[model samples]
Target: MKDPMDLDTPLKPPPAPGSDSPATAAPEARRDRTAPEAQRTDAPKRRSILGRVLAWLVVLALIGGGVWWFAFRPAPEMAARGGPGGFRPGMPTASPVVTATVEKGDMPIRLNGLGTVSSLATVTVRPQVGGQLTQVAFTEGQAVQKGDFLAEVDPRPFQLAVEQAEAQLLRDQALLKNARLDLERYRLLVKQDSIAKQQRDTQESLVQQYEGTVKADQVAVENAKLNLSYTRITAPVSGRAGLRLVDPGNYVTVGEAGGLVVITQVQPISVLFTLPEDNIPAIMARLRDGAHLPVTAYDRTRDRVLATGTLTTVDNQIDVTTGTVKLRAQFDNADQSLFPNQFVNVQLLVDTLAGVPMVPVAAVQRGAPGTYVYVVNGEDSTASVRPVTLGASDGAKTVITKGVQPGETVVIQGADRLREGAKVAATDGAAQPAAPTPSSEGPRPQRRPQRNAS
Candidate 1:
């Protein structure tokens, strides 16, 4: 509630004790003095805050750089040292490996196949005539020769048939004889005019009819004899007999499912095998030249040779489904090593390379480029990779057509650690000469012995 003019007016402090001045000072002077002091104090605070922010930025940059270096660094061993053919420092000097010298030898070209032993002749003996089985003459699993008695049926019935046929033949013969006698008498009667011509003709016809009957009876007798012989069954071939099928007292007939016994010729047996159809051309060429190729049969594991044989024949046609051809080989199984239906592995020697550079099959290794081998340097005992061309292999030795020569050493074992110029030592525990290094000088010369003064 004061006056408006009084509110607008400013107040001032009391004057100093010794001065006599006005009570109020200029307002502009007071504002100017305080503004300058406030600016000075705020300037120092701004500079200190900026310095702390820059220091924090520097620390964060240092931490990010260290994390990147640790995460992306390469392994020590795999990192390149100086250049190619140079290994890292502190690495082992040489790798120990087994080696073999390449040699010139004859290598056989062989074809391997799976086969089954079969008999040249297998017979199932059965009764030709139906009757009760009376006796078995041969034991099971017995070896018998041709015409050996195997079993017998009851021969009494066959014998009775033969006797009946013989009696009928005798009766017809007597009738024929009587008719001939009557014909002779009829001709004599007609010539003497004692009997009519018609009567003589009738008698002649009777004689002819009786002669035909006698001939028919003779054939019956022969047939009956043949049946009698069949009652005593004999082996049609020479072989080892199998288990008896029809025991004594069993009624066996000609139409029985399984025969009485089975006979298989094992002494001179055969094997049936199949080979890839691609090999047929080579095999046929050898056969055409009248060369008797040798075939060997081994057990299922191919560890032991069962028998040696000659290639007997080849099938005319190839199997379409499997792209193979069947071949038969005959063996003189003298030791009875081959048995019927036995599984075996077969090898056929088709051709032989007279002289070829060969090495152990283990020396060959496949890489990205192709097949290669590790060839050891003779002077320095260091290994270098050599790409090679391969030929036929017999599972143990391989024929090297190129990239290797006779008497050159090749690494066969412990080659996993080998590089292009790696040093290698023999694994056989033999003392090996020290590998030549880059700093090694040539062989030192020896001074001649000085002559003694006289």
Candidate 2:
């Protein structure tokens, strides 16, 4: 009977709820009624949210721990990545090291300073006599020996004076001859009583006076010749001549204001420098003790030695303003490197210390006590800063009088980043025998270690 009204499609059968028969409705109502589905869906979703929150919390804790490790730990401990040997398990690795053998030797403490090149014995050459400059024998910049003729002043005036003196001498000689003949006749007449005694005496006196006048004329001739000879200008010392200040025609006044050219002696140049009064005792001790003080001059800008010489003079008094004493050193400047008034770094070696332990200046750290260095221990490779006594210093190297040994490697490269008892993995990883690589040249990229900014 129901099929008669229905189409070919199957018709859903209607159920009665009060008779305990199942019923189907909207999709949402069906889902709400399913117990297993509700519980299965809720359980997985809740577990997923809790897992996401826990994961985020764990990530934050790890980040916070890493930051603490970096900030609070020492450089060595950080370098190890929170473990020994600069390494941590399952972490990025560090470079391994092979050690170098360190040994003891006589370290010469080199004291470095900037200096200048100069020349000595600069002099002003002046014309001795004023005249027309007749000849110039040397060029403006030529080197001349002592007594080399430089120029000739006009000698015509001097020559004319000499001629006049010669002519006067001839006249004077004729007068003297006549007087002598008269004196002879007067003496003979006196013997025979042919003339009075007064007359003979007068003739003899006239002859003597004429002889004195002739002698005076001769001296005048010599004087004229001396002035003529003075007209030629000569070099007083072997030296290099500078530009002629006064040309040949210019008149030159003699004695005080007299100068023709400046002559600088180029060989065996002297360096005049000053040393502090505090250094005088050491300088004198070396000199008196028969230890020759080697004075070395250097060009500061170029950082090269200009000359080396023996110290010659030490001034008597200390300079009030600078608290220094004047000193002079002589050098064989065959190459003409040194000049007068040229400022130079004068290194005076008071004495040499034999077999003194030395270290790079960087290794010496100034602490509470005067000076100290970090001594790396053999057992744990830990370091403790120990106070030291020191002596003379070369700007690059320092003299260690006490405390540390020569063979021990005092950290030069990484010292600025270290502290007491901090474990240090030597980037070079060995005891260094002598001084460190000259970082005065600055850091080289290939061998440069990452500096500890702290």
Best by TM-score: 1
Model 1 vs. true fold: TM: 0.68
How many residue pairs clash (N, CA or C atoms closer than 3 angstroms) in each of the candidate models, in the order given?
Answer: 0, 14
The TM-score measured for candidate 2 stands at 0.64
Candidate achieving the largest lDDT? 1
Q: What are the TM-scores, per candidate, against the unseen true structure?
A: 0.68, 0.64
Candidate lDDT scores, in order, read: 0.86, 0.71
Worst 10 residues of 2 by lDDT: 441-450
Q: State the lDDT of candidate 2 residue by residue for 332-433, as single tens digits.
A: 987877776665666666666677777766677786766887777667776678788876565555777888776776666666666777665655534445
Q: Stretches of candidate 1 above 4 Å error?
A: 1-97, 181-204, 379-382, 421-454
Error of 2 at 100 (Å): 9.0
Q: Candidate 2: where are CA atoms >4 Å away?
A: 1-120, 170-211, 248-259, 406-409, 416-454
